[model samples]
Target: MNQPRPIFGTTIFDGSQARKGYALNRMCFSFNDAANRAAFKADEEGYMRSYALNEQQSAAVRGRDVLGLLAAGGNVYYLAKFAGILGLDVQDLGAQQTGMSKEEFKARLVRQNDQPAATAG
Candidate 1:
């Protein structure tokens, strides 16, 4: 059987690295100041809204649904644009979740959390 196609958000790679995975034209944003990060974290939606994206674009941010955005004819470029507008440091986010990429880590975390804990013998 054919393997499922990977999406843009599925794997965390630097803008340059991501290009190797067919994620070209994606923009990367970086914030060095902790205060800026905190501010962005405080209200990501508000920060994204400040970008002045149209109704469809606004829905994409509000949903946090990458696939939805893609389904709506948006590509990695647009999604990365959204990330930039929201003040997200894509490179940092990708770097923070190292080893096996962010998507793999997220899946692992979900699987580990869902499994029942082993009892001591």
Candidate 2:
């Protein structure tokens, strides 16, 4: 019997999600090729059509919403390529997920790095 999975506010990119996002992931993977990225930049709608993305995926791509993409079955790793097209790195996406501005997120990271580890007496 298949058990219902707990999603704790995040989509799990398991086999079912993989199948659901195959076309979307494939399209993002194509971005690894410069020409394909150029083609997408030239005509976003046309590029999406070639990939046969469903409405949800299409909207997510158009909005560049990391959470939206994840809800639309996007695997974060693959979606990183899509994010790159918008000049956003993983840190930017992490900030978006955490509702922090880029500078705030960077500062938080710096703070964590500067914190001293607890020592046992």
Candidate 3:
């Protein structure tokens, strides 16, 4: 039998996660609007409060803790909006998720691409 690969550094975003993340996701979705994004930039705490984010979510937002946000049920797509406000990109998030510097993460990706694909059992 081909054993399943062990996933790391994140959780599955399921119904439970969706429920948990509702407020945070909604807040991020609001960022799609330039006015809303400006409002959030002007008053981050008030914006978070308006969305009713729980303590964990609020803390993750305050800390710019991507992994912590994921653990708090934040969706990456939504979080990407939030990240953009902070001048970060997906590669930045990937580095944070893997506990590596951005350069190291990019190099690792290149190394992986150079390797032959693994055969399925």
Root-mean-square deviation (CA) per prediction: 10.8, 2.8, 3.0
> For candidate 1, which ten residues in a row score worst on lDDT?
21-30
Predictions ranked by lDDT, top down?
3, 2, 1
TM-score between candidate 2 and the true structure: 0.86
lDDT of 1 by residue, 1-121 (tens): 9755776455433544343423211211322445544654677666545544445544645765454444434445545655555655554344332435666666766887999999999
- TM-score of each candidate structure, all chains considered together: 0.33, 0.86, 0.89
Those runs of model 3 whose alpha carbons end farther than 4 Å from true positions after fitting are 1-6, 118-121
Best by lDDT: 3
Q: What is the lDDT of candidate 1?
A: 0.49
Of 1 and 2, the candidate ahead on TM-score is: 2
Better of 1 and 2 by lDDT: 2
Indicate the worst ten consecutive residues by lDDT in candidate 2.
3-12
Quote the lDDT for 40 in model 1.
49
lDDT of 3 by residue, 33-91 (tens): 99999999999999999999999999999999999898898999999999999999988
